[model samples]
Target: MASMDVSAQVSDEHSAARGHCDVELTHGLIITQDTIRIVDNNQTRVQINQGNQLLVRGQWIELDAKETEILEQYNQMIRDTVPELVELATDGVNISLNAIENVVSGLSDKEPEVLKAQLQYVEQALRNKFKRGDDFFYIAPQSLSKLDDFFAEEVSKKIHTAIQGSLGAMLIALGDALESREGNIEERINDVGTRMEIITAEIDKSLKKKAEQLALKSEEYCNCLNMLDNTESKLQKLVPELADFDLVKIKSDLQYSTH
Candidate 1:
């Protein structure tokens, strides 16, 4: 809202020594050579002994309505320009500190050329970061590193969006693939269950045939009962219900038949 004011200050005692007053806006400190100009929301205070036409020089001391509007427009232009530069740079580029320094140094002397160089530097840096991906995240320090990366990612994403165009089909395809994979897993599980059932039926038939082949003698039947008990114990490890099988009753019946 406040424009910079540059003024010449002179006092009666030290009128020979021409002094200048330039207030630093960035810091809220009042700085003056021999006089001070204080402005508030209400009014402005100008302190100087007005001697008729004593080479008074000031930059309007403040901005008028028109000047303020123009200043705002210029600020907005700067903001817009920087983002555009970042986007352009991030496309595919590289920038060195030296390049940036050179561009900045030339800014005062060659305004147009310096601006172009600055844009190029920004673009190169951004492009490099985008290419680096996760690796580039921690490369920069706190000062300007974070800001540079932020701008680079923003620009890179913008470029990607522009190139890729539509995302609707891609999303739909992803969803369909996920659904298909889930169905395949369910079918495989059902197949496994069917195979397990067939295997269990075959094992049951084999166990019955083995029991019929063994002849019952007194000691042999006792030993056979013991072996079956042991077998059932082992089977319980694989199938929990096998542990509840009538091992004790079967052993008693075999012993009775043998006697």
Candidate 2:
């Protein structure tokens, strides 16, 4: 009779007559919802404690190096699947951001009259459907910035130049009257100075109000640009992780490793 190793003996008499394989794997088998029990060819019985623990109760059936390596490989393969799913989620976020940026840019690049009309529609929808009032003004930084650019380059310059030319003509006339030594020259000089003072004050007040409005508009534009910059920075940091979503490559690697 072959002397069997004492550590490899089975507890039940019905299972003791199995072949001497020294040790057996109790866990790490083909586990699914239906099947729960796993035994290694009856040489030794393995009682699964949980998902990954294998207990032999009274026996110390040890696994060889090959068996241990196989178990490690299976666990590593399972862990590697997680990063692939993360990459897919990141890709979806990137797609959403791209779509939003494209829509905003397209709307802004339109002609001024068309853009103004479109913004009016947007404002109405926000008020009617979304229940957002003049909040559209707060969110329309980019659209408003584009409008300001149009006004500054096309409208404000011509209007300011016309106003300055009119003021210069009035000043020249007043200077001519003061330079003469005619009757009531002193009265005309005082009258011209008073009118000039009034015109200067009005012009100063108008310019100050316009400057304040332009400053506010510029601040809004800068804030929007800053927000976009932050969003871009965050997306760039995640790009490498996003690029790792190669499903074909992951599957190929898993197949090659199994063989």
Candidate 3:
């Protein structure tokens, strides 16, 4: 005859087995779902399905897995698509800054009629530029006053030169002023372009990092689902034979001699 040691915990005292095993897990006075299990060294080795399933066999192997079926509820937390972030930058310079710069550079070479035409062109560009917006460059507001001030200074100097009495002197003054102004304008454009390049690279880097993170998380989630599916299939195959289980005989088989 084999000896059995059993321990039972029942909140309101429920019927237990006739002391068959060494340890028995029972929670009878529970209002909600509870569990029955086998405890080995205070660790549960056999559990009657209540919550998450964690199996420990022998000394080293354990199988604990989560199912992604539950992830459907929180799937909305994952972003559907990575945003395409773009950054555009422009300063007080107009869209036609290049064209105006060309006109200014050639002012000394053009006749007064040509100068008048070029001036008219620049005037129209300024008007349109003020109304235009850089939709991509949304980080900062367009400094409208700053743009107006720049245009005002440029026009004031050029108009003053154009209205001079002597054509030779007028050409010299206009050429000098425009050259200086064009140099400054070129510097600003170059600066803006360089900054724009930096911004674009940063945005690209950020998007790439986010894509990698999303991919990694998706891979992990998929792996969890696969593990759960495999585990459930294996359990379904193994658990039905429980009707023929003989615990006392199995324990006797596992008993070993100590030196």
Best by TM-score: 2
Tens digits of per-residue lDDT, candidate 2, 75-121, equal 33323322222222122322322332343333233223332343344
| Model 3 lDDT, residue 18, Cα | 16
- Clashing residue pairs found in predicted model 2: none
Task: Name the weakest run of 10 consecutive residues (lDDT summed) in model 3.
Answer: 79-88
What TM-score goes with each of the models?
0.15, 0.23, 0.21
Off by over 4 Å in 2: 1-182, 231-259
Candidate 3 residues 36-122, lDDT tens each? 233434444444333433223322223334332322211211112111110111222232334333443444444445445545654
How many collisions per candidate? 2, 0, 1
Q: What are the clashing pairs of model 3? A: 5-22
Relative to the unseen true structure, what is the C-alpha lDDT of residue 9 in candidate 2, on a scale of 0 to 100?
39
RMSD to the true structure for each prediction, in A, is: 44.0, 29.7, 28.4
* lDDT of each candidate versus the true structure: 0.31, 0.33, 0.32
Summarize candidate 1's per-residue lDDT along 93-180 as a digit string, tens digits.
3332233334333322322333344445545554443223322111111111123334334433432332123222322333444465
The residue-level lDDT of candidate 3 at 73 comes to: 17
**Candidate 2: worst 10 consecutive residues by lDDT?**
132-141
